[model samples]
Target: MKTFTYRTATDTAGGLEPGAAFLAGGTNLVDLMKLGVATPDVLVDVTRLGLDEVTSLEGGGLRIGAGVRNSDLAAHPAVRRDFPVLSQGLLAGASGQLRNMATTGGNLLQRTRCRYFMDATKPCNKHAPGTGCPARQGDHRNLAILGGSEHCIATHPSDMAVALVALDAVVNTSQRSLPVSDLYRLPGDDPSRDTILDHGELITSVDLPALAMPSTYRKVRDRASYAFAVSSIAAAAKVADGRVTDVRLAFGAVAPKPWRALIAEEALRGKPATRESFLAAADAELAAAEPLKDNAFKIPLVRNLVASVLEGLTS
Candidate 1:
């Protein structure tokens, strides 16, 4: 490994300095550095600053410190009981040892698992600037077709993040608190960047608001567990008087970000919770889906998964 300056942060406002990257658990950053995907001049270790904690907020929301380990978050009794989606998502990733070392913040910032993005030899906009994206035309079976531009086709890779978006979670940063929905940037003109966070900003915590609605996360991949998603759905529904009052739906692997299917939610709200209504809502969200030649199956897969998730939520 190349030598680099390293420091331990003392406070949240502590400077990371230009050309320096914040180190939480080093789960993702260290791996990227070894692959030559990220080469920072300095690494500011924030693990010593005591940001690891899980606290209940005044309302029904929960506050999770950035430094909190994945294992802890996944196994927390409160999380397992109140936010099973979050627990389920985390438990579905990596191994027990890895989850113990991985931090909540690092997981959110984890880059796409796209093969092109990870392989230095391949042409990927996310890995090399202005080199162009090969996945757009070459191999796109596992890539994102929605919200993708001519520059890139990589999908965001975080099962927990998808659940967080559906739960209306907010990300607290050193600079400012941003909604999880607003954290990701669409791969439009710049596919190299995944989020709107500026350089040197450290994620402090993730705050989730009170959700009276029923929520669930459903992920499908080639492998049964510990594999990246091919298509997944995170959904929350509020049912009253046998009618859906409100709903939140986010689809993964189909878009550049954890795509919130608002059109589908709108269609389901105030409607009877039935298989037909659920399918209609899923169709509304995927109406504009433009699938690639090899990955056209994702269109139906996402639609069916969304329908299934909503169906289960109602049950």
Candidate 2:
């Protein structure tokens, strides 16, 4: 580990120096630093900038501060009642200790847990652009299946992001507010950049629109607990008179960013809420998936998960 200077920031703009990283929960940043994947000359502590509140918006939406802990957000009455998918997604993630320490913004910015990306000696394009991505032909059983390019196939590891995508959440940054869908970018030629955030831009809060429909989050992993998702679905649906009125589906652990199943949703809208309809919709979305050698199972996994999630939500 490198020796570094640490300071708490009272304001967002003036404190960010070159080679400085903002610290909130230190769950992901500290782990990356210990692995020598991230080295910072200065650490700016933003945990005490009064960004921890979860406020209710005027139109039954939610304005969750960046500093709010995962466990608190999951257990909040409004979240549990209105957006159960978000709550369930939070609970489905890391262990209780990590949930207590992980913050909303920190979770949003968490990196992929790809072995090549974490190991300093490996040829990872995400770690060092133009070096090459060994995961393309290596042990990538848990990597991305969709929205990946030749440069990188690493998957985003946030369960909360999957749910937020389904809920149509907006990420509020210091500079601007944008849809969560726009917050992440596919690693085209530059695998080093995970999100669209600039050097000094900071996330301040996340805003979720009103969601009053049946929703759930289901994750399939190698283990039952304290494990990242091998495949997961966050789904929200509304069925009226045996026909699907509205539907939203987003997948995790299968794409560079949260894979919103917009194609599937379009197939399901105005269709009868049945197993056949769900399966067809799932097929439409998974048709675009380009799974690698070790991760071909993710194709079927995503298909079944999307169908099952929709079935459960409509039931």
Candidate 3:
């Protein structure tokens, strides 16, 4: 690891000094630093900035401070009652100890679990641009199958963000407010940049809209607990009298970011909430998947997860 300076910010202001990075819970950042993937010249401690509250908004919305702990957020009564998917996703990620230490903003900014990106000796375009992405030809059973590029194929590893997408959550940054969906970016030709936020911008809070959607988060992984998602689904459906009135679905561990299943949602609207309709809707969204050698199973995994979760939500 590189020698670095550390400081704490009393207020949210000013662009980051060159080569500076924020420090919240340090759950992910510390690990990356140890692996040599993140080598910042200075660590700005924002844990004391007082960004750790969950407040009810004026319009029945909920505002979550970026520094709020994962475990606390999951246990919040309002979250469990109004945004079940968000709470469930938070509980499903990591282990009990990690959930106690992880922060909402840090969880949203997790790096890929791709091995190549972590091994400093390996050639990974995401770690060092133009070095090449060996995962394309190597072990990529858990990498992205959608929104990837020749430059990289790493999947975002955030269960919480997937649920946020389904809830139409908005991210509030020091710069501006935008939909949580717009926060992430596709790999395209540049895989190093995971989010569209300016390098100096700080995420302050996340806002869940006034509209309510009783939803759930389901994750399939290699193990029963403390495992990264192999394929995960966050789904919300509105069905009345055996007909689908509305629906929302988002996928994780199958794309570069939390993928909104827009096609599937569009297909299921006003349609019968039956097994056949669910499968067709799932298929419609997955038709564009471009899986590689080892991860092709993700396509079917995501498809089945979407169908099954939507069925449960509707039934």
| lDDT, residue 304, model 3 | 82
Off by over 4 Å in 1: none
lDDT of 3 by residue, 116-201 (tens): 99998999989999999999889999998888999998999999999999899999988899999999999999999999989879
- Per-residue CA lDDT of model 1 for 1-315, tens digit only, reads 567898888889745677788888787789888888788899989898788999999887899999999999999998888888889888877778889999999989999888888887788888887999888678888888688888887888888888999888999998999899999998887888889988878899999888887778888999987778898888888788989998988988888899989899888889998888988988888888878889989988988887788778888
lDDT to native, each model: 0.86, 0.93, 0.91
lDDT tens per residue, model 2, 221-269: 9998889999999999999999999999999999999999999999999
Q: What would the TM-scores of all predictions be?
A: 0.96, 0.98, 0.98
Q: Number of clashes in model 3?
A: 0
The candidate scoring highest on lDDT is 2
RMSD of each: 1.3, 0.9, 0.9
Off by over 4 Å in 3: none
CA lDDT for candidate 1: 0.86
Which wins on lDDT, candidate 1 or candidate 3? 3
